[model samples]
Target: MEINRRDFITKMSAIAALSVLPSSFVAAMGNEKVEKAKPKYPTLKCDVVVVGAGPGGVPAAIAAARQGAKVILLEEDNMPGGAPVDMYVPFICGGPRVGVFQEMIQVLNAKHTIGGRTCETFGKTGSDGKNHWWMPGSYAEVIYQLLEKEENITLMCAAPVVGVKVKTSGNRNQVTGVRIMRNGDYQDIDAAVTIDATGNGLIADMAGCEYMFGSEAKSDYNEPVGIEVADGKVQPCTWMLISERIKRNAILPIDKLKGSSAVEDNLNRWVKADDKEDMIRRDAGIYLHWGRTVYCKDTRDPLLLAQAQQEALERLQENLEIWHEAGYAVHLAPKLGVREVRRIKGEYVLTANDLIAGTMHDDVIAHAHYSFDVWGMKIPEEMKHIGPYGIPYRSILPTKTEGLLTAGRIISATRIAHSSLRVQPICSNIGMAAGTAAAMSALNQTGLRSIDIKQLQDRLASMGLFDGLKKK
Candidate 1:
């Protein structure tokens, strides 16, 4: 006779106790079946849960903690630093790097700078006009120190969020927390508010939230620039590396490299350099190089990404030999620099027009200043350096989702707008806003969308988040 699942389990449990009985009695029940053990998931509760402790998530967690919220910062990697540590993208691109991002950079400039001149004025926004990059491990060191200082933050590294815990109510999904893979079993961390700072919108995507992937046609968002038709293309993946001179006085073979630009440290800004030799001579101990770039068949797929990385490595063989012959050792990044992924659709989808016009929204929480630097897409030189634009609060709130917020480059924006704000500093600022907002939602027992916008703005402003843009 067939037994129900519960009854079967109960009977199997009773049979398990039969091991203490006589062998004859146990043997008589040989036809009894035993069920395989199922994995048990442990549950945890917190005020705020921030996933992906990179530039964005770190600040988000810190901001929430500072607001008196018990924050749990989850990172899939063993350490906290995001792209800079994992992907070796230690280069700083866009500007107005204020708030928690500014704090980290200040520490980086003071203690971790490899080639740049010593920063006399800490926390100043590009006043020195010096560009700097630290060793990849330096970022991790600084991030760890910053996170450790926050009393309310519980950081969990190597905790990958495999699933999202949500409560569904008619078309809307309210995110409660996340399920992370831990010790071969699932552990759920339930929080009042969840922030998706995964940079790829992984949490939001897992929560059944609608998201946009790939390039959208110019007509889709009515942006000023973009292709006429949606090409389903994205920015190419770059494999970055740091090269150091193993032998004393060995020159970097910049001229021999093809398709890769050898970026020497802060002698002169590499962005607009007229004399490469002069810049190299000023400071040349270490150099950051864009090793190789390749277009993945599908960036969202792990197999395709691996294949693309293999292709990039194949292309970089000649350069690797060149560097080795020059007595330089190259440290390849642990992961490929993926530029784009899922963009969760929010209440306001930022577009190129918002950036071009520098629209200052009433609910502006963060300010981003960067040019349209979409890889593989050619933009007019004149339109490249647009003025600072505002990132509204609505842009971080995923559509129809409660108790959840989007942070980093994955926040709501068209592809054109994303290309600019996707940089580290801007992403950090956005994360700070998301974290602060999340804390408010958790403590006040209010929905993410129902929080007072003015209060959020005031809190952000007090934190120096609004210092980047001069309000009109």
Candidate 2:
């Protein structure tokens, strides 16, 4: 029970499994021999079986289930809140249109859910100048309840999808069902259609979908602003932290540090700005946990990345000392937030050009409005001041795989393109889009590649996707 820094490090090693889960989860598996009787699955078949209940996966499963299709959502983690609950992603930003998203937020909102009353928007997040709003209770319960309340959906936890059962009809190979490793036993679940909202495209790759890894070249996508990405170098992925400010915290606001706290910290920085470089209250919603940390990482060297994470933690701890010096106590969180991972390839790759052009697709299912915000050890001078962008349907469908789709930050887009598209709102929308596509394909008895785009678009519009658009 005694825990010191050494214990913390050891515990972190155990917890690193969260980002990738155990290699045991990734261990190739098939029908394993068992002695006694096997447990029955949720059902022999479902309209859609979405793998991984992350940002996009949850929404996709919900959409399909709502669309009158039987759904089964699988997650390796026990509870289904995804990043919000598992990690201290305490402050969620980068969402727009907010009707459904806001309803979800309101449920998680401290006002309605926890008795903390406020609907205030905080100013620019970090030096990035991105607007963020606050809510309470983490919203994990609210999201899970919504899915559970839906009669058409089934939820499965601690089930790692090993692969899929595929069948080829003509030149197209479609995913018929999935193979999963549940509690050390390998089994199969047959479904009419399947979704690869697994984030890494575990389903898409297994189903033999064409894919790409890392940032795309500017020439490849023809995005005028595309960067020439280098090998062994990514913008870096941050495992973020969220900590709440303790009672009587004295962390200085950027404004107060600048000697300006007469105004509300959140309002002054986020809304009323005398100039673009205006400051907000630094302590607003400050979690006593990991404070002012970045996930910039080197994927090539695990040790190097681990060191970066540690350094970030140290710096954050130093800030906690700052809180203590200011006469407050700091409570650090248990886990870190993830920023980047492997994105799955889709049929039509969304490019940076599509984003800059403010492109809309006839089959546009989701939209994102975030900056070309790349993270790393440092922010390059060239990369700054970018804003929100778009995501297209092509980015969700795999190139050579049918009955499969990807959502969230792992969609098939160039890194720069994904940089903008991977917002929380967009991830939720794509989840809905991919789930609906799988459900519609199953219900209509068509290949995922051949689902009616017009119908899909109309349904999405009905669900409040891409609203306020002149043309959808």
lDDT, model 1, position 50: 96
C-alpha-based local distance difference test score of model 1: 0.80
Best by lDDT: 1
Per-candidate Cα RMSD to the true structure, in Å, reads 9.7, 9.9
Cα lDDT of model 2 by residue, 279-392, tens digit:
323335442122344544433234765676686666555455554555544444334445555566666777766766667777677766655665543334454334344566
Cα deviation at 139, candidate 2, in Å, is 1.6
Clashing residue pairs, backbone N/CA/C < 3 A, model 1:
none
lDDT of 1 by residue, 1-472 (tens): 1111243233334544553221111101122211121226667889999999987899999999999999999999999999999999886877676788878888887787765543322224733445578888999999989988999999999988876665654445678887777877767788999999998787877665667788889988888798898888889999999888898888776767777855655453452234647645664767788879999856778889999999999999999999899899999999999999888889999999999999989999998888898999999898887858899999999887788899999998999999999998899999999999999999999999889999999999899888755521
Error of 2 at 98 (Å): 4.5
Shift of residue 442 alpha carbon in model 1, Å: 0.4
- What is the Å distance of residue 85 in model 1 from its true position? 0.9
